[model samples]
Target: MGNGAKAQQRRERGGKDAGKGGKSQLKVNEASKSIVCGTCRQSFMTTARAPALTAHAEKHSKALADCFPDFKV
Candidate 1:
């Protein structure tokens, strides 16, 4: 294939990968850090991988709320 064709192919593949649920997977490069939700006082871990972090945060919220009814934020 010509160089231009190869480049186009690579771009297309990259776009497809990005279109997938790339947000859910945890990226290895970013450090894990705590995130404080503005809506709640509870803190949760966040990472470069927003999808995984969001999932973890939601789980934390549910567990905390279930364990303590009075839990706020």
Candidate 2:
């Protein structure tokens, strides 16, 4: 019930090191309105009227599946 115990609980539930020491997993470029994938390092631009981010994520998922056929995402 102390500070150490509370920190330990947070760590167990993936709160303390979830972002690898308070760093973001995604790198966003505000000027270009685009995001670069943290894992594969792929970059893409966004549109005004469509959900381009979702499509880009799907590409990452597909690439992951192709690279690791036996692994479950």
Candidate 3:
């Protein structure tokens, strides 16, 4: 794929470790770092991988936006 296509793909999957300045706010150390549910504003523990944080997202919605492979922008 060309650079444009790769960039679009990265933007579509802008989660942890995807690339620089991703949509995910997940972090490993600080408790202050966490991701919030867009619908409810609920807070979830920050994690680099989706499995660690996918449960709560799954509870409210099927798609794990900014947490898993699901894209949220």
The candidate that achieves the highest lDDT relative to the unseen native structure: 3
Ranking by lDDT: 3, 1, 2
Candidate 3 residue pairs in clash (backbone atoms < 3 Å): none
Candidate 1 or 2, higher TM-score? 2
lDDT of 2 by residue, 1-73 (tens): 8999999888889865676665553554445544455556654444322244445557667553343333232
- lDDT per residue as tens, model 3, 21-43: 55564444457646666666665
Please, what is the TM-score per model? 0.22, 0.27, 0.35
lDDT of each: 0.52, 0.52, 0.59
Error of 1 at 50 (Å): 36
Every candidate's CA RMSD: 11.9, 14.9, 17.8
lDDT accuracy of residue 69 in candidate 2: 34
Candidate 1 lDDT over residue span 1-73, tens digit each: 8999999999887895766664553543233535554445554444324454456457667543343343244
Off by over 4 Å in 3: 1-31, 66-73
Stretches of model 1 off by over 4 angstroms after superposition? 16-73
